[model samples]
Target chain A: MEMTVAEALVECLERENVEVVFGYPGGAVLPLYDALYHSTRIRHVLVRHEQGGVHAADGYARVSGKVGVCIATSGPGATNLVTGIANAYMDSVPLVLFTGQVPTIQIGTDAFQEVDITGITLPITKHNCLLKDPSKLAIVVKNAFHIASTGRPGPVLIDIPKDVAQARISFKYPSTVRLRGYKPTYKGHPAKINEIAKLIGKAKRPIIYAGGGVLASNASEELLKFAEAISAPVTNTFMGLAGFPGDHPLFLGMLGLHGTRYANLAITECDLLIGLGARFDDRVVMNITSFAPHATVVHIDIDPAEIGKVIATNVPLVGDVKLILKELLPLIEKVDRSEWLERIKSLKAQYPLSYNRDSGLKPQFIIEQLWNCTKGDAVIVTDVGQHQMWVAQYYHFKKPRTLVSSGGLGCMGFGLPASVGAALAAHPGCKVVLVTGDGSIQMTIQELATMMEQGLSVKIILFNNSALGMVRQLQQYYCQGRHMATHFQFHPDFEILAKAYGIPAYTFRTEEDVIKGLPEVLESPGPAFVNCIIPPEENVLPMVPIGKGISETIECE
Target chain B: MEKHTLSVLVENSPGVLTRVAGLFARRGFNIDSLAVGRTDRDDVSRMTIVVEGDKPLIEQVTKQLHKLIDVIKISNITEDEYVDRELVMIKVAAEPSQRVEIMHIAGIFRARVVDLGSKTMTFECTGNEGKINAFEESLRPYGIKELVRTGKIAMLRGSKFVALSLAQAREAESA
Candidate 1:
């Protein structure tokens, strides 16, 4: 049927099963927004800023395992999505971003709201296209979603000129994409799978280093079975948190910088480092040469480039990890790794992750309590900084996609906006929690109005430390304790701020207050905020300082 | 670092060259030369990229290039039995006295005198890198006024191929 390109774009989205798109409209995208207005099947979320829209989409994608869609107008609106796009790219989140461009005639004329968005986002996006023809709109949209959600998923951008969006065309959404270059390997080589099975059978101290790809592949069950079969301790990267059950006996918690003491130690001591859907990031693999020095690293990932890009891979299996794990499961001989398991238990006992009880109103305590209140079922979205690390450290995530924080990009203002999307994507009765710091929350604080407007029951846990705790800790250790520009001298009263946004607010100044107020805040019917004041001096402990191996960790401040 | 020639087949789409070039520039992969043109199939374009890097660096480049959506196929033809060519045009300052000597050099190197001027003679040559370099060197003493060269373009010996079918491509990726 014939329709405007904008309407056709909306129709294409509906065909792709996209329920909502987070966006902020502008002059260039007026036609597209108009089309969105006429569509009843798809909901358009009006975010405060373009960045918020993208992040919210990212959060939604992370939780729901679907291609999150976001839209923005030309120039500044497009530019504002850069960071969020990069964040998604780094973390391998599947997102389709539609940006409005100036009319084709005015594209290169430096017209108002004109920008070369496709060129700007080239390095960040997995794939991008500037749709110049009206007829190609459906195909481009189809390609965008296909490329975005496939193996090793990441953000894909489609820049539609204003004229292209307004032009009428016979819309026919392609049922299948035929990209010669975009084929992703899904099945692991049979020989390689056999080799891995043999390695697992022979291994004494085996550890499964799982990352976000495990969750991306939805291979949590396979991972569980494999770990249990081989009796290997599973250490998660920060992105890999919640991929394996946190309460499992074989779970080694998050490993790398700021990881649990035992998790890092296990990586150092393990003989067989089974890297499952995990790229050894610099943050995760602190010193390349010494990292898993005693181990034979078997890397199974979807992206071939990541195999030996950083850490050398002895056995590189390039395919979808879930499928790979499923294939290798039956071939595995159950190994009794009692000695290694006992060693890990002793190590965990020796280096328990503990914070000082002397410190007042601890962020760790709040996260733990939040975990208890939600019964480890909440989708905990967090912003970067000390509070984010605290959640990663303390929150016992028993399920995959439960912890939705910015892992690779570590963007500071990710929590509130991301929680907005997480809340929307989550299953009914599933609580969405936002853990933000005083410094991190203020970056995208306007998102509070968004939460209130949407009436999303996101439980906001603000760890007000009065300073950028992570950087301050770095300054303290690395910069001779000169805490310049890290401390916040004066901040707005968050309780009053929450009230202005028409959300209930609470302040936890003491331990007794947290014991009384935290559960009540979490249990509130609508959106609620709790400003839990913590000491600025506290640091995320057991950090593997820069240039050092994971074994050389700072246990305490 | 060794010079590695990569014959890459990509979709003949707008900005495909930019995607290829931008990748090299941003990833710090040094491109010695890059020649791109439409292939036999109009929908597909072939790019011959001569890059300077070690074995691992070349592998990294190949893997990264393969990730691009427009990139159809990549062959590191450096070690393959392949025929390579580069085109060069040189304008040498040829006085009446130097004309014969320049012509003799050009004739010996199988270079065609494509253009002639009163003060200079333009020689167009196409050959492997070595032949092109030697031809340019022989005319260097005669005061070369201008020189332009097309980057290296390569193809495998007959029967061997780079553009594989879907099934063959999958097999190649797994291999």
Candidate 2:
């Protein structure tokens, strides 16, 4: 079957079962867009910016369990996707990005819209290719998908030259990919798994520190079973928010810089620390020497490089978490862990995640109200900052892939566009709520038009602090409160901004207003926005300042 | 820190070298010396990297290198019985009076005079790090004008091999 490379590319996408692609077109991608024009299988979403398109694809991948695909044109269009690509890479989201390139003959001549995108993205991407030969397009696409979605998934880029897209080729999607250098270990070493089982059996106070890898490997159920079999309390990393049931007794909320105090205390005192698909990030292990000092660390991750990269591990299991957990679960011997459970209970009671109830229209209260209104069922997405921490603290997620936020990258402008993708990928009638700060939302507010255009059911919860709350908090602690560029001297009315985008908008100045307006806004049809006026002085508490251990968290006074 | 020599087998593809080099630069892993060339297989290339790190750090470097999609296998051959060699060329000023002494020194090291200019003599030498350093030192008193050296290349002793089958077999046995 002879076809143009662009047409073959579309066929390859169909073969991969890609249902949707978020992209912005440009001159360099004209031929590819023409091919997409004739395709009926894959839906093409035109985002307001290339960054939004990539983020939308990221959200789509996280929610759908598929390799998210995004497309951009040459130079500026490709550059616009850089932040989003880095965001996906840091979070280990499986994404395939296609960028248009100048024609092959003009590649190095500094032709219009020609950039060394492959070189620019080399350090960031897991793998990348610049397509010079049209005959290899199908294989490149196949390889890109395989590399992006496989073990320890990350982003991959395929830059197709304009001429190559226009070139004709015989299309044959390879049934099986054979890369001699790219094999991933999917099963754990039996000896190592046995060692982990023995370690779990011997330990008295064991804690399971779960992260995004658990969710990536679809091991949430196994995580629950492993915890129950070992009777270990599970504390989630920021990315691991929905990996365990938030309502479960063993659940210790999130443990990190702004983690729950009980979770942090449990980490400090636990006898054994079982890290499940979780990298002990700096935020999680604030002081490496003091972090889980008495605990014997057993780090189980698919990526071999991550083991012992930061925190030293006593036993390392390098393989799929779900498979390893299944093997280890059978070997687990449930012990009487009432003493540790009792400690956890007391710690939880003593340092509960609380805020001032007397304060009006608090961001944390809004997240809690949204949780109540949605019944802990909505797919909550959030941008980075105070509101992001608030969502992690307040939203009690009961399901996996329900809380989609930028954990590793902490990209500020991620919420609105990502929610657009999440809403589309979510199950029909499932509400996709975006909790964003005023400063963060404005960074990519243009995506609101994209959301309205798609008629997505995303309820926007904008926490209007009129300042960058996280930075201000940091300044108060670290900069002697010399707040410069932290406060937004001129701020827009988000309600009017949302309304201008044709999204039904409301503003709540009081807690009573939120109590009355939030449920109605969430229950209403199509897309809507609610701007809650929050106090600028509010801060995300229980913060473990840098150089301090998790045990040294400062609780809300 | 101790010096560790690693033999890495990678696919011969565009930007694969960049991928390897970029990884080292970004990860802050210090490379003492590096040399890349074609292997017995046309599609595969071998890179001999001499890096400075402690035991745990070397283990980390090997593991991180293995994460690259193009990197097939890596062997830290520092502990193994291996033969290492580096080729160095020195261009030194040789007056009519110093010719005999320079040639005598070259002959002692088994180095050959590859090129002769009007005011300089270039000697090509191949040896281990000790021999190469000695060769440079002996030529230094002769007013050496320029010098170049190929980074270290090494091979395991006797029947030991750094082949794909051997790596796969080891992995299989461990599994």
Candidate 3:
């Protein structure tokens, strides 16, 4: 059937089973949006801005385990998606970004609203392409999705020229993408799996350092099985929060700069460190010379480039974490590291995650109350800073994909729109929480209108400290308490903003009022927002200063 | 810090050069010299990047380069360099009196005068980097006016084995 490239794009999306997309349309994308106007099977949510659309897609991808889609016009509209695209890249989220371009003939003429988005997003994306031929549109679409969703998944861009979107083509979307040089390794080597098994057998103190790869690959079950089989403790990276059950006895919580003391202590004492789907990023592995000093490393990641990028591994297994663990499952024998568990318990008993309980509307207490109320079942998205760390520390996660926050990029203003996206894709009536700081929430606060328009039941808990909490903490410790532009002196009354967006708004200032009032707000059927005023002087603790090892972490005063 | 000559294979796509150069800039890797040209297949372009860094730095750079999807393969060719060549074009301050001496120097360096003027002569020379450097130094006394060098291009001497063997080994592994 002869059809316009724009119509073919909708058809191609249908072929890939895409149901909903987030986008903001403009001049270059009018043709595609016209086709979307006629399509009944695909639903398009009009976002307030291009960045909000991309982040909404990211949230959808993270919560639904499906590749998220977003569309934007050329030039500034496309450039607006850069931060969100880079956020997805750093966190390894699967997103397919479609941007409109200038017509074929006027590509280099610097046409109006025509930016080279493909060029702009090159390094930050998994792959990107600019379609020159209308007939090849189907193939490029397939390739974009294939590259985005497979093998250390990340964002990919497809720049469609305005003319190509208007051109006619005999549409047939390819069933599979076959690139000669793009075959990802799925099965790990037998030798390394066996070596890891042997190491598991010999080591009395072993720790499994899990990351986002496990959750992205849906290998959490395998991770649980492996940890159980070996009786090893599991500590996750910030991005890896939901990869392992936070309530399990062997769970050591997060391990990094702001990681729990138990997890850091266990890491320093471990004999065999198993890295599954986790890049030993500088944030996770500070002072590499002394990180896991007593451990022989075993790194298993799908990306070969990440294998030796940081720490050298004794056993390098490059493949899907789920598949690798499946092959290595039977080779394992049960271990009883009672003494190691004792040490972990001692550490946990000695240094528990604590906060100023009597302080005005403590953020940690609020998060703990959230965990108590929701049973750690909500899709909790957070913006960066002290509030994000507080959530990671206080909210005990029990399932994968429960925590949807930017990890590597540490992006602010990611919570509100992401929560809307997560709510839309989640199980009907599933709780989606946006726990954000006062500074971070203002970054994309316009998305609240989108949430109201879409009627998404997104619950937001604004940690209203009126400052960039993380930056202030850094300056307090390193810059001799020189507070600069971190202050939001004229911060908005978020409750009033929520009321303007036609949502229920509440204020929780006292620790008593928050604990008493939050559950009612959470249980409300429609969208609700709570402005929780927290102490501005509070900081996230047990922080290992940059370039310092985990053992050097300092606890609270 | 030592020097490393890295051969990078990349898809001949738009903005690939920017991605490569941007990676270096973002990571603060000081590139000594860089040369890029089409490979045997027009679909692929080859970049020879000369960077000054030690072993760990080179490893990190190589790993980071591999993270770029356009990059097909990268090999550090500094260890097994059989042949290296650099092309230079120089405009020398030459009058009728000094033209013979310039011509003699060109002859000694096996260069050709691609362009000529009454008072200045432009000579093109291609040789190993050391020889090119020596030729440029000799021309300095003759008041070299302007100069341009096409960095360096290097390959193994026998059988083009670097590419052939690498491809074959990858094929064997894939098979």
Candidate 4:
């Protein structure tokens, strides 16, 4: 049964039910590629860059609910995966990143194609391993997947030295991982669940603050049941968008900096704020002191550290959100709060989501058009900026786990790669649309080759404002319009770049053009780009300035 | 709100402390004291955190800690029969006239004078939280200048509760 470690790795991947692997071969990973050649069970996707590989895996994971796998060579190749890994880490996507390394003999010698990827990725990954022995390959691979997918899932990297990959060993995928230090609490304690139920029962005006965890744990049903059982309205953070149905009677939409007026007002007025699988990131908690001033916070999450990390919680239920909600639902007393529901209804009516449609080629209008063409089912990935916030504000996502955007890190250049990943993961026939800003798309614009090469059916809708929109907006608000690095005057034409990547490109100058171009782009079978030139002065309205209270939102210019 | 001791096992990595501490700080959770150190495994670290909350909230906190990707295991060893100790190093301005009195007070608390200069002396003391608190209090009257204390570290007292060995824990997780 003796075989090379590289062969063992492929075997382990097979055992884990991994059918697709995105990667590029290089000098350091020759043995792995050689081994991959002999394996027919797994299909290897040769991406143009290491970042594309990681992002493809990210998309594959997000849509399939499986750990995405990607591999790369040493040094620069491994470094290239950093941004993508950080993206997965921020959004809590589960991925297993394998990078080749120089032989152990030349590890510290600064040999060609040698890098300490484990050390370099330590900050960004949930955990990582440097494989020195071929015997540990199966165990490490198994453990990597386990760590990557379990409680508060994130990316994990395993650096296999060239020699280890070539070395001979008997391959046996460990039936179970044995890590004394790692044990995720899947079930919530009965007593704590009772306490949460009691808090829900006692509160007059309760709000369920949902976050990405709800989608990550696949707890939408539990959330719906709990929200209904307690008669509470649900408000979502950016990551929490698809966790609850937007069109539901109790849905208050997104909250915080770019949140809807109704959602923010509900947060301000609620007596009980039950945060499920959502960390109160600063963007969501504009002024921590004034946030939910009257609410008794009940924070439910898998990560214990997140309980009191941002906003204080009276009842901190630590465990899987789905499990905790399941427990709480059964213990709760059912009651109808018609009056509270009516008040929220009134608030929703008074402050419905609206944007000025008079502006030429408005980002909101483009998103609305995109939404119309796709019918709200298309997986929407966005880079960080005004366009990202606008999409979060305007897009009405009907399905759970449909909207794939960076919320935690708000990393720019995330849209293109993440969209590629989402497109790859989408159910056959579903389109993946990336609504990106001109500045954010340029960060990883090299991925254009990935789209062409993979022939992924994704629509790249670029909001070409020729500026770092978010930073520009901040400067306008805080620094008296002394636009420093926020301006991008020399930005390249996205349509031209899309053509360079062998993809059809279109440009929309007017609202009629946007309306015409979107349907054509959405209906296309292959990867395409729509460069919509937008006014740089168009600021994202209903913005809660940094450090300001939710009540202090700027509605219009 | 009663204070409870929580022992958390976390993967050894950068910014893990920040993530953990940031969570508590952001949540407005009152942390009485905290300490962290490497465990038997090179890749894993252990943290001892003391916080004031109800029994339900404390259990929830422990569960939440387990949710952190870096966090491996969380146990509320507060109710368990165990021995807990905290180490505190305090630098006191002990003038020539007060040196003997300071040394005498240190002796009463079983504290060792680890360093001494012409005008100051550093005392090293290790004991349960209460003992360290008392030692610090006793030195406060003598013009304490600086103090540093390692949060409590606890070990079970009986054979029944074997500190789940790394292999056993990993096996359970894999299972």
DockQ, every prediction: 0.47, 0.44, 0.26, 0.25
lDDT of 3 at A502: 94
Better of 2 and 4 by DockQ: 2
- Candidate 1: clashing pairs of residues: none
Q: Is the docking of candidate 1 incorrect, acceptable, medium or high quality?
A: acceptable
Q: Give the alpha carbon lDDT tens digit for every residue of A1-557 in model 2.
A: 99999999999999999999999999999999999999999999999999999999999999888999999999999999999999999999999999999999998999998889999998778888899879888878888899999999999999999999999999898877766677889899999998988888889899999999999999999999888888899999999999999989999999989999999999999999999899999989999988998999999999999999997899988999999999888888778888999999999998999888776677888888888887688899999999999989988998999988898898999998999889889999888989898899989999988888887878988888889999999999999899989899898877778889888988899878988998898889988888888999998998998799889988888
- Among all windows of 10 consecutive residues in model 3 chain B, the one with the lowest summed lDDT is B166-175
Candidate 3 lDDT, tens digit per residue, B1-175? 8889988877777777998898999888899999999887667788999999988789888877877766777888887746778999999999989998889999999999999898999999999888899999999998989999997887866765344235522331110
- Model 3 has a DockQ score of 0.26
Task: Name the regions of candidate 2 deviating beyond 4 angstroms.
Answer: B166-175
Model 4: DockQ against the native?
0.25
Q: Candidate 3 residues A91-186, lDDT tens each?
A: 999999999998999998888987888878877898888888899888888888888899889999999999999999998877766554466889
Query: Could you tell me the lDDT of residue B158 within candidate 4?
Result: 75
lDDT of 1 by residue, B4-72 (tens): 999998888889999999999999999999999987766778999999989889999999999999888
Give the range of the ten consecutive residues with the poorest summed lDDT in model 1 chain A: A171-180
Model 1, A1-557: lDDT tens per residue?
99999999999999999998999999999999999989999988899999999999999999999999999999999999999999999999999999999999997899998899999999999999899878888778888888899989999999999888999998787776766678899999999999999998899999999999999999999999888988999999899998999989998889888899999999999999999888899999999887989999999999999989997789999999889988998999987899999999999999989898795887788877887787787899999998888888888889989989998999999888999999989998888889999998999999888888887999888999889999999998899999999999899999999999988888898888888888888777888888889988998998988899999999863
The TM-score obtained by model 2 is 0.98
In model 1, the runs with Cα more than 4 Å from the true position are B164-175
lDDT for each candidate structure? 0.91, 0.90, 0.88, 0.83
lDDT of 4 by residue, A1-557 (tens): 78899888888898999988999899889999998999899878777788878877887888788999999999999999998898899889999999999988998899997887877776678878788767778878888999899988999999988888899998777787776657677898888888888877888999999999999999999889888888889999998998888778999889998898889999999999999999999889989999999999888888776778766678878799988887777788976788889999999998887777676878888877777776777788888889988988878887886887777777787778777777777889877888888888887888787777777878888898888888888899899998999887686767777888888999999999977767877887888888889998888878888778996788863
Provide the interface RMSD of candidate 1 in angstroms, 1 decimal place: 7.1
Clashes of each: 0, 0, 0, 20
> Top model by DockQ, which number?
1
